[model samples]
Target: MTSTPQERLRLVGREEATPAAMSWVMSLDDSDSPRDIIDALGLAPFVSGEHPHALSAELERVKPDAALCPEDARILRTSDDESTKTVLAAGEGWMLRVLRRTNGTAMLHVSAVTEELARTVIEVCSKDATVAEEADDTQVSMGFWHSGAHGFSRRERTIGAATWPEIEQNYSGDISAALGRLMALRAEDVSGRLLLLHGPPGTGKTSALRALAREWAQWCQVDCVLDPEVLFSNPGYLMEVAIGVDTYDDSKRKWRLLVLEDCDELIRGSAKESTGQGLSRLLNLTDGMLGQGRDVLVAITTNENLSRLHPAVVRPGRCLAQLEVGRLSPAEATAWLDRELGDRPKPAVEAGGMTLAELIEARDHPTRIQAAPADTTAVGSYL
Candidate 1:
């Protein structure tokens, strides 16, 4: 007395089925096979796509009214303190999911019976999410890169700093002149692909680079590599940073400047011995075969002196500009302090001139105890 497959399927859910479920069951025809009925109930043959962008308040504007899916939310969260959130919503024949993180990043997934519906949902959610804008002239959009569990990832941040003109007085006169030339460079003026800034710490090297990024924001994309040692040691990681698609515009790519800070060990005269192929790979990325056809520039900051760096790195024609970001001269330091202190009595300038950091410290706390400078000869001891 075994019933047909259709009868078995209908009977399985009969007792517990809601009115809507029962109505759907009754709509099944005799011509429909068990597999066809199951497929129809599960919404098969749907189109799906995903888009990622910076999380913004505009997500509230997504159409079809996305709602929270409590069951699926925070499943990927490692701890209760985590800030990742997930929401989902479904309409007549479409479903959308949004996963937003605390770091201002989000991923959107949409599924629908038609391709057009999926695309429309994505467009609505991503319209204003991907735009990178600064709040003011003092801030510039910069990308920060790091290798994570998910792989290499970059997050765009609006970094705030003084303009080159505002901070030009911070560096030595010679260094300021060289940097002025470098900052004023047009795309055609790029003779070499590497930019090297070598000096002891507290000389305003990092500050200068920040200003440089703001100046070139119009034509060059600046990305600071957080883990440069890993970048050079891992070929895959280097390639990912070097040739990865520019998210800004794919049609006409902009120049990129990759900043590696405190890379003393990676580019020293004995780098080949200490870092192995790390130095070679870095050289290749700057001007060798790896650099050909790519509008990429490598800008490195280190406490190592220029003479102590690898010959290949500082050789003529390799670096677009090799500037020594040293402390200002005694006269320059005295003038800076006088200008900064104004009517207040200025602190005595060090006989050997003063680094920007020292000058700032002096201006803020003229009487604080000063420790001896860290040993710069040791790699990674000073930034």
Candidate 2:
């Protein structure tokens, strides 16, 4: 049966697609043209002999009925009898292309896509929306004497490798001390220490933060910032959603364990004066604002020396107790292996002086790893 625009859209929103439907649809704004879309999506130039057209032609040859439809306002379908059809529709200064397959699998493919994809398509297909929703979401954060920056949505919950027991086993003494401080945060008698974990690249700083996040998530909201660049593009918007910081109209549930990973990027000490502004604002949010009530727990990870951070960040009242997170100690290394390989230390016996992050990368997941039961309401919770 031929699919209408609504049917096609419904397929795009679904979780399954037929093999023939395993295709990509790209919609570009006025800021995006055919050439720009090609570059953005990493497609080869149409002019090159070994280019995009070659692939499309190959698709056509395999299915004689396959064809390309001309660009138009309404959804266009190709007249060719090929197994697949490339339909192009342009409107309100934007372009939309859908590759429709004859087989049942098209529905399956569209169904498996992410919400970001669905949202992007909807926005692009709507009248005159210019923002492209497919921009890279992986955020990188760095700070001087602080944790790194990370980009994350307020609504999404991220899973990580470490857990409470893992953190306790590795950094027992430090974790114990942190726990005391964290518990004290409830009283408002003592200010909480912003755990400033610093170490070498590939060190367990980020891993430790993830572990810390999982550990404290059960008790308080954990709002982590994994990217710093977002601050540069939209400082006001960034602050509105930044960890431990709330706006005039924020809800009570925003209290969190604010984890800022790789904060050194913002205050690396070599950049321009403007960089300090974000760091200053971040510090204020962590301590100055949240410090009064002690309702927030701030964890910042960095590779830079704490002594080098700007005064706005490292002052005594701001982040007094800085903890150094390095490669796992000898005891930590052995214990970690014991946890992963229960009775047998097969990999650990052979491996030497590797961080948990390194070991995780070296081994395949769902092997030494067992999947934890999915959290039902985890998406909206503090974790």
Candidate 3:
């Protein structure tokens, strides 16, 4: 009688459980043979329902390590026969041929091999990545998990207020800091914090916020909340973000960052001076009772100066820190212009020089690009 993988684990017992060694255990669904179990998972139509052969064809096409049984509602585990095939004699026994990895750890997969194991198989397989064994219910989800592991989708292009290049160039360093903050929060079992980016227009604040989302997508899930009015109008969006229902994916279980663009538009100046329910709603979203136990990073973009913003909105301990993005200096401006003009006689720019936006605007006209320093007495048109 051939012993099964589960029996083998029992035979190997304490020895195989060594800290230095680990093995893989894959579960395959068997409840529905010849039936594409992919449909039950609610996968996109492009991969399952839309195709003629559906999941079976796709699974066979991909040739995953193990597959669901076509006739019996069971899973079949396989490995190379070159190595020793272990036989563990136990109740409901089976056989397993170990697969050796470079790390020298023996890998084995076992399934319940019964009609009842269908749901478990799909669950084990449906997991996009290693699912957490256990997490606190009261804890706010980590931002790194949200942006990188949960929120991002390879199939869908991210829609943001800024262009891809604009986002990358702007958030290179700032994104790193934001992600670091998120990781720290996760390490300390704390929730995400809001990042307030306030300054004059064209300073790359908005672009940085978007880039932070994309960069953080490598580890944390990030979602951009455009137009607070639309989000709060539905009430569901507000509820979702408030209740931790607005998550990157099912595995993550909660949101990491609630990117609120142009929050100033929603909460700017004195509350008495503003004209919408959006502002108060945003305030409630950030500090309200529902916000507790949730990790939320609110990246706000505003043209208004920080000093002038309403005390309630910009107060310390509320926003954490106010990042100021002033206009680019002359050196930064020249570098930016050089990139845009590509050999059109680089302009002499200094710190507090023409902003990138201004350089682009000015570079469009050849005369302005070659214009003498305004202080140079302009070589007089008389010459």
How many clashing pairs per prediction, in order?
Answer: 0, 45, 25
Spell out the clash pairs found in candidate 1. Answer: none
TM-score of each: 0.71, 0.45, 0.45
- Of candidate 3, the 10-residue stretch with the lowest lDDT total is 52-61
Ten-residue segment with the worst summed lDDT in candidate 2? 104-113
- Native-to-model Cα distance after best TM-score fit, residue 244 in candidate 3, in Å: 4.7
Q: Tens digits of per-residue lDDT for model 1 on 258-282? A: 9999999999989989998999999
Off by over 4 Å in 3: 1-156, 159-192, 244-255, 335-344, 348-352, 359-383
The reply for model 1, stretches above 4 Å from the true place, is: 1-81, 86-98, 109-121, 127-135, 247-252, 366-383
Pick the winner on TM-score between candidates 1 and 2: 1
TM-score of 3: 0.45
- Deviation (Å) of 301 in candidate 2: 1.6
Q: Write the per-residue lDDT of candidate 3 for residues 1-383, one digit (tens) a residue.
A: 87554542211111243344333232334333221222222222112222112111011111233322222222233223343222111112221112232222222222232423433433333333222334432222222111221122111122333334443333224543553453334323433355677766666665555545554543455655544556655565566555543445756564456666565655567644464566566666677765666655566677777766776677556674467666666555665677777877766775556544566566786454455554645666543
lDDT of 2 by residue, 166-196 (tens): 4554443564466445433432343544667
Model 2 lDDT on a 0 to 1 scale: 0.46
lDDT of 3: 0.44
